[model samples]
Target: MSGPSPAPAASDGITPLQQMVASCSGAILTSLFVTPLDVVKIRLQAQENPFPKGKSFVYCNGLMDHICVCENGNTKAWYKAPSHFNGTMDAFVKIVRHEGIKALWSGLPPTLVMAVPATVIYFTCYDQLCAVLRVRMGDWAQEAPLLAGAIARVGSSTMISPLELIRTKLQSQKQSYRELTDCIRAAVQSEGWLSLWRGLGPTLLRDVPFSAMYWYNYEKSKSWLCERYNTKEPTLAVAFISGAVSGSIASTVTLPFDVVKTRRQLELGELQAKNLSYQVSSSTFSVMSRIVAQGGFGGLFAGFLPRLIRVVPACAVMISTYEFGKAFFRKHNQERLRGPLQTRNT
Candidate 1:
């Protein structure tokens, strides 16, 4: 029998630009698959006390009573219904049944706009920062991925938050600004341009630690998998499993912050606009307190299952594609450069 195939070189000749391109492509493709879950997660997170209601029809106007869980057409209190998704699969079915298949992709525009560039910047910085630290710290470079991921995520968040704010609002049932410009204009007119950064604080809280944990776990898991499986280059299955495990762990640890972030981004200003009562505070601490008071500790994990499911697969796809893309590009680019030299030698 032929000898086992040689292990592929790890990140050999993988330039920062190539890393970025690979990451961006992976993230965009992932977003397409997972945006529906994102929509459901946002809706679940945006649920608040005394939910909104309006617009009712008798013969199932694309919405079922159970699907819109909170608001019942027969309630005689409001025109619209509250969302009542059972879980991830239920959310998918309900959204498609009631709102049509297209509804699953709500806010996709802002998602892509934010995610593609954010991913590019994050991966590029991660690679460069790891390189610098690896040279300086030797073994300590193992921790570099964690710090680099966190720092890169925070840096990208400044730009990504505004788009996220818009997307959250668009995805939320509380308001429907059909156009991206409409959302921006409305926020500017109502809350000033600064409003676009509404949840930056909580976003940072969720993202920084999340990024650190995710990258750290991902790196460690990758190393462990390779060693356990007796492979140098991780197969796609190995990469996907490692990423899924890492993402699930990180997501679970950081879920409470995500709930707070979504609420702060989507509900705070809307409540203010409608003159509704909310024990509002600028601090995430106080917001967390309010959520706890409202729904007990369990409320902190409003969309935990869906978020976990979405993140696991999304992370798997993104990480695997990123690794594969880097490998492909690196090999192709080296071969291209070598061709000219080989011809000269011949």
Candidate 2:
């Protein structure tokens, strides 16, 4: 009998190009789905003053121009819209009714622009770094995901931080800038170039730890689920569940830093909007202390509910979509290789 045909060469799992494509797709979908939640969350977290009910005020969040009635004392939005949101559900209803549905997607343009590249860099780097570190660490490979996730987050967050600053400004503003460039020009002229990177320090503090925890938990959860299900690779369900659990835990733990980051960025945006020369403090701890003094310890956890709600689904959708996309490309590549090999055998 003829010797068994040589085993087919193992296909490289997924190329960086494939990873980028997958990550881009996931980012766009996640932004579209979660932006409304984000808008409400920011509005809640950034509101320092209360609006009395039935007060009509001019609302200009992103491109929206409307007169909104504040139904609750707690309602606020980008540009001090009079429609006061009492909570997450209230914010959703008021924003939709007063500003129209499109207002829910305020800041979507900047978010998409920022998210696509950021997610691509973040996810692809994490995957590549994990692979490299796992091999290099040998017996210590189990810790690779934690280090790789943190490193990837630091790199990606630093690169896209300017965009993040812009996005937050767009989302939180109550006034209409003629265009995005107008906002950028105003900020640069007033605050100088370094203004673009405002809040980056708090961003890194929040994100690096969140990334490390998220990836560590996600890997462990995915592995356990896969083993339980007798699957060699993670399924969409596995990815979704793992991501949701990991994201919820990380988001909760890192929320206080998120609150600080929002306050810092919003202070800058407000200063730029009003053409004020006053300097805002950049100390994260200072902000935290002020928050505690103002709202008590509860202040540090502002918007916790909406944030948790947003993060759970956002993580599930983004990660599952990314994994599915990567799996698709991997299968396509393997099939392409198989076709040539089979033809050669014949």
Candidate 3:
């Protein structure tokens, strides 16, 4: 009888740059995709400034408790919709086109600077903690449902908040802050350092679930694809599918958190000083309740439809491109390995 064939080994062709590009490109694509929705979201969020309609949106809302604007197409905020996407694309393309290859990486520096440490800490902390939990819980380990994903997300996200705060403020309006430095100076001079961490609480809450669901779906989908296809190796297509599923799962759990976070950030001037209420119920329920009390529940979900529409394609493209690039690198590495082997054998 023939001996059983040895099992195929997992491919080690993946590179660090491939991994980073795949991950970061997913994020960048997500930003591009949801940008229009982000603009609408921001306008809706900034209405919290307690200002009357038709005035310039500003950083403050302490002048009043709340201000209501009719949800009509004619609203002044409607005109500003182009600012987010237009400005980002404009900035991104210009930076890439003119700034040599390094320009695409300019905005990326702060992002990576923040994201890398956050990711490292998240994975390390969550894994270490979960390992401890598993040892303690014994049979109850499965019950945890990968709970560490959320915690890890928060752990990493904490480091990323300042960069995100700065990026969002800059992206919200192009001309307002001449450059990143200008945005920082203006936000600090006018809004205070707290402005840099705007909506931090809600952001963590959002990220926790977002990360949890992302990891859960990714692992599940990847396993399913591998098993169902009965293949030793799955392609980048599988990765994108898994990523998209994870993104969808994450978005649902964290969306309301995003809504509240946006509102909080836009109204940073008011929430900064007196957060007694914030400390108590920064939980998701309270955030919804407060928005409803001010503008009704419908107001809370105002831009959700557009958000779903924008996110799906953006995420698909983003995830797909990242996976494709990763696959390309994997193929290149495979060729590299085989080339030397073939030459030596010859």
Candidate 4:
């Protein structure tokens, strides 16, 4: 009766290499899709000084060399009447009309470079850690996803923190650095090597908790949906819905930390651009307190709308594509293994 439960039928989960491949594909696609949203989000969050209506100001939120004008109640870029952005749509239109469509992808190069390795490490580590923790925890395995996700994020974020700093700086000012190496060299020369890791504290504060919540909720939601739908495995739709729900919840809760991180990064970029030696505050709490003091509690939540919009679909598309790729590899591996067995039997 039980010949050992038929030896559990050999699991067909994809290998780590497959996972990395899937994750890389997902990261590239997600970056291309969401860069516009990211650009707009950064612009909104980095704006500290308000450009009053009908006033021209040198607006630099990663894309320098633009005179922001408020004309007809709309913020226009580059030598138009000066005004504040009405909202996200206004910003989008102005950026396109004045800066060109490519402006929306201002940080694409660094983003793509960061995304590939970051996502590969992140997803692969999460998957591996989850498997290990599940087995180790035994009966409490249900909590593995949260822990694994948090740990994975910590590792990946730390590894890619420097790239993230560069990406943020590049996004905040246009053509500030002649090249990537020039940016790194300037920061190192001005602030020492540690400067490259600036804003990492706020980054971890935002990312680790978000990762924990996102994976926990995603797993729970996917499980519930699967049960309701009577499916043994998650479909693309299930993954997408789960990702959107989890991402939105996580992004909202972590929005404050994100705002702080953006501010810190932008300040650093400005300092480096000016070649100024004045160091900005590096403490996460200090930054948060300053934001609160300057703009009330609501200030901590700048760019919430664009962030949510970006994260929801970014999570949805990225996770679904990643899961689909994993599934495809799993099936392929199973067939490949089975072919030899069937041939031997025959």
Per-model TM against the reference: 0.72, 0.76, 0.56, 0.76
State the lDDT of candidate 2 residue by residue for 1-346, as single tens digits: 0011111112246888898999889988887787776667556644645445433332222111122334343444343444556887887887788878888777576446666888899998998888777767878877778998999999998888776655555544444656777878888999899888866788798889989999888888887887788776679999999999999999999989878876765555455454565465669999999999999999999979866777788888898998889879888988998999999999
Tens-digit lDDT track of model 3 for 1-346: 0011111112245645555655555555444444443343344444334333322232211000111222232344332222233444554444345444342322333344444444445544554555455455667654232675776666666666776665544433333545768757877999788777765677677667776776556656766776777654455676667766777666765667767865665444233222223344555577689889988867666657554555445545554665566566667888999999999999
Using lDDT, rank the candidates from best to worst. Answer: 2, 4, 1, 3
244: Cα error in model 2, Å: 0.2
Model 1 RMSD, rounded to 1 decimal: 7.6
In order of listing, the candidates' clash counts read 9, 4, 0, 13
lDDT of each: 0.66, 0.72, 0.51, 0.71
Worst 10 residues of 2 by lDDT: 1-10
**Tens-digit lDDT string for candidate 4 (124-226):** 9998888777767877777888898999999998888777666555543455556767868876999899988765677789889999999888888888887
Q: Write the per-residue lDDT of candidate 1 for residues 68-158, one digit (tens) a residue.
A: 2223223543212246766667767777777788777664654466668878887777667666665566667677778878888888888
**Would you give me the overall lDDT of model 3?**
0.51
| TM-score-best of 1 and 3 | 1
Q: What TM-score, to 2 decimals, does candidate 2 have? A: 0.76
Model 3 misplaced stretches (Cα beyond 4 Å): 1-11, 27-152, 167-198, 235-237, 269-286, 294-302
